[model samples]
Target: MATAHTHVTKQQAPPHRAAELSAFGVLILLAGAFLPIMDFFITNVALPSIDTSLHASAASLQLVIAGYGVAYAALLVLGGRLGDSYGRRRLFLIALVGFVLASLACGLAPGVGVLIAARIVQGATAALLVPQVLATFHHALEGERKARALGLYGATSGIAAVVGQLVGGLLVGADIAGTSWRPIFLVNVPIGLVVLLVAARIVPGTRSEHPVGVDVPGTVLFAATLVTLLVPLTEGHSLGWPWWTWVLLALAVILGAVTYGVEKRAERRGEVPLLPPSLLRLPSMSRGLVMVLAFSIGFGAFMFVFALTVQDGLHADALHGGLAILPMALLFFAGSVVAPRLLSRFGRAAMSAGAVLQLAGLAWLVAVLLADWPHVYLWAMAAPMALAGAGQSVLFAGLFRSVLADVPAHLGGIGSGALITLQQSGLALGVATLGTVYIGLAPHGASHAFAAVEYVHMGIVALLAVGVAALPRFTRATPVTPVTES
Candidate 1:
């Protein structure tokens, strides 16, 4: 009897040990997280260079941008599930390797078609990589450590947005190796390789306590639904809003309904679905997702539209265009850095305050645009941009923290995946819907088109602020903790 008891104790030991993460390890993980996000923003700045060099048509340029996004958004949940079922660290490494190879292909591609294909693959690889980062932080660290890590993650989002554009501008202008815009993709090779080498050693492995096989049927349906919805929205304006676009949109709705039904059935059958319906019912998660979606749409649209308006409309070069967004990025970093302390003091009110600041910034931008018209430059736009950035920083920091605060540890991968999927989808949708509006209005004038879209973005921020008011406040007393491995 004593021997059997000892054996049982041994069996429990591995599951009982709480994982701890080091600062260096967190940096490594954040670096991996930063890569894909940085790529997305960098590509925004590189678009014109790509267009001029590749001679890409309008529709093709849209594809270059939307292709990566569609693929990433569609498969993200599946990637998260794969990490949970197998090993988060393992999946992350595999995805990084794929990202490196795909980035190489993108840099070397001789034509628009190859570049688009490479970019789609690159996006798909990013899907596999992202959830693992959040899941690691969720499972490995506890208490203040977890909060600090999360704060840094939020800051990285804004920092990458700024750095990506800045780097893209510099790289394209430099034309290193006489390859215009190629360095943007190629540059990832060395950094990714270094991260890959160190990650295997530094990154901890974590998976769901109750691992399950891949839900093939659910993955297929989910992918189909996203593809159908995003494809038409992305390409429609460039394609003259074809009848097929509407058809695809309708099919997306049908597929989405079907996907839900299938997931519900899977839950009833005691089988794991891509996203558990019950998970969505969690008050913290659901409410946070709503706010996140709205905020992301505004952010995504603002970035894409603003870049085009400044560069194409105002005839600013890539460097100047990127510089124009610098103030926002800088202030965003500041807001993220102070967010933890702010949250501790003000709780969810911090997010609401962020929304108000963002609204003010948008109003300011409209005023500046009206006053300066075609004469506007980076210095002229600094104040409003900084205001908007600070607002976005606080809003994102709070929303990300609040959403995952109550997630069950075993569901970390799935929860992280769901949150990110919504965010990415929001980003894609913003680019599609708001981008289409801006393009349609472009004939009137760049300033007119930009002002109109800014209003739309402002409306989204206002709604997000109201949503923040309703979110449950997070306190230091209620720290995010991991569940038992069993």
Candidate 2:
């Protein structure tokens, strides 16, 4: 009996287990992932409440959301580089802990100004937390096993977005034993503690042997270029067109060109760079990043607009808003779980289909909202919402793995960072552009604007499908590196 018990304990260890992850390892990491993704979306549903409680203006509110996303996007590459340089496991643990503390700061913030500041820090910590998940999965699981791990990760991410929106609604609506809207952020504490315990016990330590150091100059340039572009776009709605905004945007373009040239020079000189020149040269990575930029723009804006349409325009309240979004969230998760199987077989065809399905959903939405308007209910909207969710599941899963497939191991951190940065920044821009169009049309009133938003959605979705169809189909279906034994 003693011998059997000892063997059982040994079997449970990450390295001692299969080259594949055990259910426990995946579950623990999933829990760790939960808070970061949840925080991103949940805040959207809670935004109206926060605005009311803190007396924030529309610009302040936009900053509250933009602050987190921009900071997260800005730091992600460097954060990924830090993990690769020191150790992924070490950075992961540090980030998870920081996220918890930051969550506390966010929940306790007394005013709109303080809350926005706290949110920016929280987003930076989240960037540190998220990249490690991808790196760990890359280092820990093998072949189909690695694919499965990524699939689960993508599924969890999609689910979290939905969960954030829904749970945020529930918490704010319930007042949660009189805790009011604060519990949405405060809820991260206990979960973080449990995740820390599990991760310390289970997540394996991994790092690149010849890890490329952070490209300090490149990182600065990249961050500066993106920030100059994003800050104006995010504020464009409120600020209108300003000469300074255009000037900053032109500077961003010039800086982006300069960043690329510097990275190429560094690569030729045998120096480690933030985004290695060699990695950028990969046709797959280059094309993949472009698609990420465009896909994110549409998807990001839709979610923001959807929230406003349901709550502000329709006068539905938090609980109703959550319920309205539930179907999309559920269907998206279902699609993500199955997307790898489809991609493994069909490649770009699978992606195209996903976009088509999503477009169909948008078409349905355009028709329904135009016809139903103020009378639309949770049930009536479920079909289109579910289809949209399904579409996102496919898009997120395919892109997540596909983007990383061609990355050289040495440049993994910056490469991963660049991909995610494109994703984050692009999504922010999408919300800015699509959101601008949606709100620009809002003057025609909610129902008409809702119809117009779908036009933006359809155009974006079609454009993404065209982008995916242009890629090397199954070129990204396989693993870039063998998943290491935990």
TM-score of each: 0.91, 0.89
Candidate 1 lDDT by residue in tens digits, 349-384: 888899899899988987898788888866888999
lDDT of 1: 0.79
Candidate 2, after superposition: displacement of residue 172 in Å? 1.6
Model 2 per-residue lDDT tens digits across residues 440-469: 777678878767767877887898877886
How accurate locally is residue 456 in candidate 1, as Cα lDDT from 0 to 100?
Answer: 89
Clashing pairs in 2: 141-483, 297-430, 332-389
